[model samples]
Target: MPSQSKLLSITTWLLGLLTLVAMATQLTIHLRLNFSLVNFFSYFTNLANLLAALVLIATASLRLASRELSPALESARAVSAVNMAVVGIVFSVLLRNVDLGSLQPWVNVLLHYVMPVAVMLEWLLRPPRTRFTARHVGLCLVIPLVYLAYVLVRGAAISWYPYPFLNPAHAGGYGGVALYVAGIALVFWLVACLLLIVPKRRQVRNH
Candidate 1:
């Protein structure tokens, strides 16, 4: 039987490759329809999946090379895990019934469902080696807050928002969008807390 490290490396490689394929396929479909590349990449789902794929691939490569992941990379893994969790939850709850006009079915499943679940499971099964702190949780929120700002600013400029919930027009105006943003931020915080707490509990049980 392969050791735990070997198994983890293989799993990460497979998942990372799968994520890349899904994102690539989606990108092709988007370009074929003449969609803005900027808008396509701006979706939190795409960005989170991209980050998750990179972190997974990088972690696998370092492990295979017998090199330890840097603390920064490990923290990235933690943040990516939290991001993917929120992606899954938000999509299922808010966007599952919404028409994503150009998105292919298989790609949708991979990005909105499979990759998110896989990334979270990977984190749960193989939690970060570095201990997490309040600072780490804060780090988890940084990209999300940045993404929120970018979406609002860009949406204001182009009159387009990736998710309807983020669109003032669709959401009944900026106030409604604010409500959605506040709710999503709360979700991010809760998921980040859970991710941090779970690993500590696991370590305690093992000890």
Candidate 2:
């Protein structure tokens, strides 16, 4: 039974990897093309899909019930699921409608702030406590940084970017783009910290 559970966990990670890859690839292509296509199903909307796939994969991984499972793995998986779901749904709505100016500002609120907030709340309340450690945290940071760097270099080589925020010309400049990217990185870091720290408090309080 334990072996079977491990298999399931591995499968979940692999699925997440695939989803992240696909979304990242699509983001690269779309940015390179400079939003050339306006259709909902085209490259512009693929980010949401990638996010959805990631959310599903994370969900699967977090649901694993085994004594051998690590607390860190479970927490990471749970947080990733919530973040991805919020991102996916927002992107999906944005893709379906290009005329953001016409809609009420509150609509934007629903897509951007509300969804993420709800997801974050869910994550905070149900924080995981399993096989997590400092090493796992480092691995998490490294993987995303490596991917971001690789994608940026790849985009530069082809005179394309993977997202609007990555496009220096469209935004304030490369500096502006860099700043935005930094902000995103900070947010990711915060999420990681929250996931890592909160569980300890809960455990102690319960004890």
lDDT of 2 at 49: 37
Models 1 onward score TM values of 0.94, 0.52
Best by TM-score: 1
lDDT of 2 at 58: 58
Error of 1 at 78 (Å): 0.7
What TM-score number comes out for model 1? 0.94
Clashing pairs in 1: none
Model 2 lDDT tens row, 1-207: 466656655655565565556444544665566654432132222433344345545555555643343554464555454344435443554333544432235434543444455445545655666645676556446544664576567667776764555667766887887786686566556556556676778888889
Residue 147 C-alpha lDDT in model 1: 94
**What clash count goes with each model?**
0, 6
